[model samples]
Target: MPDGLILPIANQKDYIRAALEAGKHVLSEKPVAKNLEEAHELITCDTETDWRKNPVHQGGFLLDGGVHYVAGLRRLLESQPSSKVCRLSSFTTLLQSHLPPVDTINAILKLESGVSGTYQQSVGTSLTGSEWTVGYEHGVVSVAGSKVVVTVAGNTEVNIIEDERTGVPPVVRIWAEAIAAGITVKDLEPEEALADLEVLELMLRSGESDGLSMSCQYQHIVSNPN
Candidate 1:
């Protein structure tokens, strides 16, 4: 047996328990569960070590597969080893030909750091779409699929670059280096992932609560790690 499987399951607790019982880690796709509590219940881990204090929280669609943007912001504010912090001032959802759940996720993210972002993902295909821009202290970094463009302060023209398997290989390389160094690396620890889920849950709640701005305060996963 493969220790664990990634097929869809109705219950989050059962799914996570099965993976843990088989002594395997899981990388599940989006729409994890009915709610944040169920999502937390699914992920089981040892609490003695307190891995939540780990220095890194990797996230961002371009940077870390959109896993831990909030943690990255925290690291950036603390002047940790990473790129400069950028403010996501305004985000717009140009396309809305998607499910109500997708629209629900578009709201409810208000960072204390003044970084605002919007989830504009859509299921319907479109020939023309809005591009994503990340503004930093030094300059701006923009990416559309494989095409990458960077505009710096001193530089006059935008610089462009491309490479096959660009983002995927870098992620794989990082994992390999960590493992080779005898470091047991978990992809976005259970607690950290749960925190992110809590935020997503807040987003859903905002939609359900008639656009009431909400604060995500659920720390259950960190407190009661399975």
Candidate 2:
């Protein structure tokens, strides 16, 4: 293992363990493990409770704090009625022919007392952009990258936000600066990161079950490593 590794490849937990065992620190890809148990095993082995020693990040959403995008999709649904996701049906498919593997997954969320909504992700289709929308009986709200749109009562409003992710320096520099400051990044804390992995694992399990619905609840990992 290299002294400071930035691993974006799959088998993320394995690489982290190997790097730590070889006296190296690593920043690995997000959803740090295929599931929560593996993440726990890695955290237990770290022993110092140092977060930077094994941080996790999603590729493009590195600075965007995207864990909330998956686990907390229910919060967005709250705009409709129910804030809890009772169950969800999901399926992943191979859509990108040249890129080689399956890159799209669509999930339909069933809310307890609100309008059911869909969460679809595609790699090479026309729906390649990142946009989130919430629909209610009275109005609709949508966010697309840096822009937000709302329509209700025969009136429409638009707002634009600065895209902080577009102009950041390389991650290596950010990592170095944060390390020098001696603090855990609030966005990647155990609570947020672990919940992201947990939701994702449940999604994959749902897909593997051939669209059988999967259930989830927001959870945090309580740890006192070393």
lDDT of each: 0.44, 0.59
User: Measured by TM-score, how close is model 2 to the native structure?
Assistant: 0.65
TM-score for candidate 1, please give it: 0.56
lDDT by residue (tens digit), candidate 2, 181-207: 755554444455565665555655676
RMSD of each candidate relative to the true structure: 7.7, 6.0
- Global CA lDDT of candidate 1, please? 0.44
Query: For every model shown, what is its TM-score relative to the native structure?
Result: 0.56, 0.65
Q: What is the lDDT of residue 97 in candidate 2?
A: 68
How large an RMSD does model 1 have? 7.7
Off by over 4 Å in 1: 1-6, 25-34, 44-105, 124-131, 154-182, 218-226
Candidate 1, residue 82: Cα displacement in angstroms equals 13
The top-ranked prediction according to lDDT is 2
Cα distance off (Å), candidate 1, residue 52: 13
Highest TM-score, which number?
2
Worst 10 residues of 2 by lDDT: 57-66
